[model samples]
Target chain A: MARRQAASAGTSANEAAPPPEKRRRVRIKPEERYREFVSKAVELFAEVGFDAGTRELAQRLDVTQPLLYRYFPSKGDLISAVYKEIYLDRWKPGWSGMIEDESEPLRTRLQHFYEDYTETIFTPEWLRIYMFAGLRGVDINARYVVNVETDLLMPMARAVRRELGLDPDAPIRPEEVELFWTLHGGIFYYGVRKVVYGFACPIGKEQMIANAVAAFLDGAASVMRGFAAEDASAPTAPSTRRRSPGSRR
Target chain B: MARRQAASAGTSANEAAPPPEKRRRVRIKPEERYREFVSKAVELFAEVGFDAGTRELAQRLDVTQPLLYRYFPSKGDLISAVYKEIYLDRWKPGWSGMIEDESEPLRTRLQHFYEDYTETIFTPEWLRIYMFAGLRGVDINARYVVNVETDLLMPMARAVRRELGLDPDAPIRPEEVELFWTLHGGIFYYGVRKVVYGFACPIGKEQMIANAVAAFLDGAASVMRGFAAEDASAPTAPSTRRRSPGSRR
Candidate 1:
């Protein structure tokens, strides 16, 4: 009886209420709204890291909490979307082809590849968020590092050997990868100095990339041969040195 | 009247209260307590970053808020102390002399220097806290970078030129410093890989350091000469390239 009375009273109140005003609210498509939410989420997470609350995200997006959740079911889902957008989506498919293209000199190919790669990656959002995620012990960085090692660093190591007319079939050694890492890590550290530490790199991007390429190329062959000689002389080297992939030869 | 009544009541209650039990707590010296706070602060900052709270730090230390404040004055002071403990105090007074020591080969010196340096710095606390602070836009990284460049990198660049029979007094170009940075940054990234990203560096530290030293020495002369040629050939080069310190020569 009480529920019925309350419903009846509420209905009477609604009937007696004044008519709402006509408003000029813009209607957005669902697709547009979803894209907007994602872009805004990237900005938010990039600024505050993974701990950014949905309430703050909603506030930034000018959307309701339910609407934000409607787009992304959970924080983990949203972060996955972010990783895909920033890392996977921005990754150019042609990079591997560029690195392996036999027509171009290896130095030229590497310079072009890193110029393109750094352009894609050396932003505040990508750099800071990566460090943040890595520090947080998130596996995304580990996964990305593996991808880089398998696809980029290892292939480049082979390319160095081929360019130097060394036995291209020789197994990749851990030291070879470390040499390549010096080049890659040095380049990445330039970005870290600029973006993370806010220090000026002093050289323009093209010139810095050129310097790193030249330096790596100048030394890579010797480093590889040095490692081979070391491996040959060591009585127990094969058992001790960790092998890179395709080490069976 | 109300305040007086409450004060009298509190005094009466205290007078009527039973004697407190004798406690057996270990008394720590003030200096010891201060050291304990800084060590814990380093661990806390390394794990959770700069946003970690004093309340939590106090709880972790098993001390009162006032006690922490007495030792640290503020969060910034505690962090400064931590920075001093980790970076400044741990920096060896012998390193500059070691690098400048003409008695030993540059490679041998670098290997020894890095072995000693990594021993001092390759901790989870040192590595993670560095990344955290760098990402936080703290100037400590910038300060440290400058210190490294001045006390270590620039000197190493000069040493490289000296070893390679290049004009020992020739002005260190930006490219020379950058070449050395590749070596330094490469070694640092090894620590980052192991400590921060939890990736295994397959080679033993001694061998890896030796590889890096050999690789850097192999190309340092050519890279330096290549820059000299580039500088000589460019019509408008003097204005374009960034000059490192002592570029006036």
Candidate 2:
């Protein structure tokens, strides 16, 4: 599987250190060093799979294993730290400046989210870490995936609720979220299976994303349609006008 | 990860052949020994993983590893045979038979098909083997997942197109099939993730599936609305459908 091979290839590809030219006068901070080391370790562990060797990590870092533990406490701690640094930190709005567009609809903004997410948030390292997390089962990896996936949905949900004027916490049914995640999951898996694992999906990435977006729009519209259908019996959401079901469906 | 642990645990749990009544003998033609071995191997592999030890296989069969391989030349040969035996003959029908009722709407029938697919195809051994296939980056695992996922969608797509009186391969600017797979990816990943690395998904399986279905419906509806609006005004789906007007804030 290219994803499995990608587990290792992407590791060194995304080394934690600043490039040589940029580092000429840079003095790295202690916590920053720890984050870098931890992120690197996460990449390595994810790449190497669960039984990541400390010795290999040291070799990768070009530092002694003893020095490695000083920042984090143990191999387990380092793995956990990397898990948080890369995957956990990934869910938050890293591109705050990017998502601040006020005029665009949530659906429009989501396209950008998908782009950045596919590029930065859902990289091979992220997936590799995820694979290990799944393997570790009750370990930090699983916790990390669940937590990140949850957080990944948060910003989008907030955006949709804001734009659509729907319930933010109003018992958003499971299927509602499933639709969102399904588009997300299909894109993610198809990407991995294609780019990472080198599988042939019948469609290209643009088509895949279009399909996902279509599905998401369709799914979101249904909720409104269903809500509007209910509203005929009990009118609510007076802010927006409802078209006839025949007109909509 | 629970998926990984479950794989290991699943094997350990079935370390022994079933007791007297459990191993009920069925008459088999001598010509079908290969077939019989393949079925048994699939159950074992899915229950455990592709990397499952020969020792375990022997244990499950109440035979020694050497004796088990007599039918096949080597471990590789045996597993390959097992894969073909079970998947080639059986996997295509994962949930094919579950949705014979044509009266059901596309959404309901799709959900029904998914639920049945989950029950029949996602056997414990299937999880183990598939997960192992992913981790090892095995070609077969990746191939089967994409193939099976696509195959599962065939019935759903045909049903939808038939309802709309659209051609099976009609180019109606990418209909609900994309939405189906997009949502499917999410649900499948969540379930696969759960099985591989145990997690109490915030919602139950049924709820999760429902959520996905809703999303797909909503998204597809949105796309359809867009399609109808476009088709009404123009002969082709507007190029703008491919690109959201702009990104969300």
Candidate 3:
């Protein structure tokens, strides 16, 4: 009787109490919530990797575990979403056009393109997730490599051939692909060294990209000249020549 | 009485119950046992990573946990031994002499040196352990990078300068170091792609190294010629120039 009297006294004192609207759950669109979960999950996965439990993710998202599961059924499904977002969705369509833009000097175009590309991908989130995915033995890295080869490397090879006065339609050589990968991998390694391994890179990103592009173009030109010289000195039998690897396109 | 009779019957069947000498523990020198433990530990760590427990290691070594601790004292101590063996002990003293040998062509020398170096390091065991060490936030990878830069990259820069008819004792440009790293990192990435990521490289090791070295030499030569041409035309003030990072050496 005393407790009831005290509760009544409290209610009487706060006769101007607000309605229950403040305690109600806020409604959000499903698509918007899904996007929010993916963005937040990318950060959490990058920070703690796939080993992070769903409880941790839920805490980071400020949501209940059941709410997180409502969006992503499992941790692997969430990681798959992250892979798609990062590797597949993040590629700007204009990059291909920029690479093939013959109006600009190839060196300037390459410099601008890589600077922009690295700006997008050289972040701690991207690099760490990439390493984590590779460590987990996922096919995402290999798939991304194949995408890079087909989308970027092949076009770059054709451009190099065009600059060298070789037939643009001619098949690309294995050596050519390897040389391009050397430059590309070198730049990527700089990111790995700095972002992943936490090493200090003495030079800025633009400077490194510029140096790599200069070296690649110059070296490729010299190699092409050597090939031209060899062809002039002794015309080889075309029948014995091996097919170029780039002919598949 | 029945148990006693059974025991006596078993002893009688064995006739002599072979002397205790036949069942005695085999004695091994402490130092030999320590070396044996380290060797076995390296294999286990390489296969399973530094997370392998002391009990696991002991089981692999066919010894008791107490016996394993007698040599390593702790897991960290065993990992330290592994770092020493892989990074420091595996380096061949003759590699420095090979790089300095001017009698052979630079291409041939680079090809031979990388071939030998890769043979030592490109194994699955070494590559996985290296990645594991890096992921574990150990100083081993950083220490190894410094060793490579000082011992290998610096000497290579000098050789490139000499080849370009520049002063061999002159400061190595950041560009020079980057170019060398491009070649080195590219080659290293090839090993990573194959061993760690389980990707198949279309080209063999020898071909890839030859292509990279050839590209590097040609590129460095062309870049040097460009610098010379610019200096001849402009005659810029040398005092205003920024020093190369390698000048610290």
Candidate 4:
């Protein structure tokens, strides 16, 4: 997508780099060169799909394939580096702490967390690379999904429980996780519309996040209560753990 | 994505097609051949991506380039057929009727509409092709986004207004449309996780749709009322028209 170019295209440093022999003589730092490889890999992978060969990547970086290989032993290693650079590295360490911060109201915490969270994940390269990695059926998607579940969605589910004055220690149900996903997924779809689908999000990200969090908080209590009520009546219900009665016709 | 193959890799009909010369002599029906071309194109485009050439597609179908061209004058025409077959043709006409059916409670209508809608759109092929096209910067995604807004999201927004006992014709604010998108996008993200990212959705589609609809409906009233209050207090506020104060920190 041309929008992706807007993010990584600002740097002409690679294009202006000295010839391979001259750069070798100048002796770039190994760690800086490694970081350069990862960032440039993000741009290249975002521009072309993940199927791009290292030969193409090295050419674009103005470095020899051997030099690229020196940093990343293989394509898979390079891709993992890209995933860390784009997805994992961009995640704010303060997010989970924000979600569980009891001093703030749930709405304020959620709104602020998402507004800040979207700021990191909402870029063109991040969105495109994530989609490209998923489309290629890489483990990057699955791994990120788990991180979101454990670090983000599950913690928010507990936050919702505590916010509603329900027992925070009560085992979080699959239905509860599903409920949080509606809010998380809804906000994510805004990013997809803006970055992936190249559609206008009309509402700016701040307003969109606020509207989503407000709507979700409004509906969450009763839905959770519905789950609680169902659990109370049939403590041993086989299907209760797996599916919500509300989902049925 | 392997899940995509699960949907389209069913029949060996193409694999067993007669030799091209024999097939030409056998004289396949024009409409039947056109339909075959479209379905096969979907499978191939979903597998390799939209970058596939006419020659490769014809070879996959066990037909000559000339014969394939007879059905679709150009590659774009063929791609258009795939879009129509996968996207437009899959939309059920009765969805809007279901959404507006006041005899049913708004939650009931929404839960039912989404359950049925997700069934139609949540396939692996549909999910992958849409992402692939969007990644390639095609108009298919833009067109589908509009269709979702005008045909689906706007109607649901209006439905939310009607459900909340507001003026159904109350000139739907962008905030209201975005509120509907939170629900719509949440459900759509479930599909993305399941189909595009190849992750387990845990809850079934029916439950996911139900949970999303319930949450959106739960919060929608106050959110809409908040909009109504803002509009009445400041009829001509320029900033009010563009951004929701709820979105502000």
Best by DockQ: 4
Predicted chain A of model 1: TM-score relative to the true chain A?
Answer: 0.80
Query: What TM-score does chain B get in every candidate?
Result: 0.80, 0.65, 0.80, 0.83
Q: Residue B57: error of model 4 in Å?
A: 3.9
DockQ of all candidate complexes: 0.22, 0.29, 0.18, 0.46
**lDDT per residue as tens, model 4, B1-249:** 111243344565756544335554467788998888899999888877877777888888787778877887778788888988888889887888888878978888888888788777787788888888888777788888888888888888888777777778767777788888888888898888888788876787877777778777878778888887788777775244455646664
B145-240 in candidate 1: lDDT tens per residue?
Answer: 888887888778878878766665656676677677878888888888878888877776676677677766776667777666666566364545
Q: What is the C-alpha RMSD of each candidate to the true structure, in Å?
A: 11.3, 10.4, 12.7, 7.4
| Candidate 4 ranges with C-alpha deviation above 4 Å | A1-27, A53-56, A64-76, A236-248, B1-26, B52-59, B64-77, B237-245
lDDT of 3 by residue, A127-152 (tens): 77887777677787887887777777
Q: Model 4 — interface RMS deviation?
A: 2.9
**iRMSD for each candidate structure, in the order shown:** 9.3, 6.9, 9.5, 2.9
Best by TM-score: 4
Looking at model 2, residue B98 earns an lDDT score of: 48
Native A-B contacts reproduced, model 2: 0.47
For model 4, name the residue pairs that clash: none
How far residue B170's Cα lies from its native spot in candidate 1, in Å, is 3.3
* Ranking of models by TM-score: 4, 1, 3, 2
- Compute the lDDT of residue B39 as modeled in candidate 1: 90
lDDT of 4 by residue, A159-180 (tens): 8888777777776777788788
- Using lDDT, give the best candidate's number: 4
Residue A88 displacement in candidate 4 (angstroms): 2.6
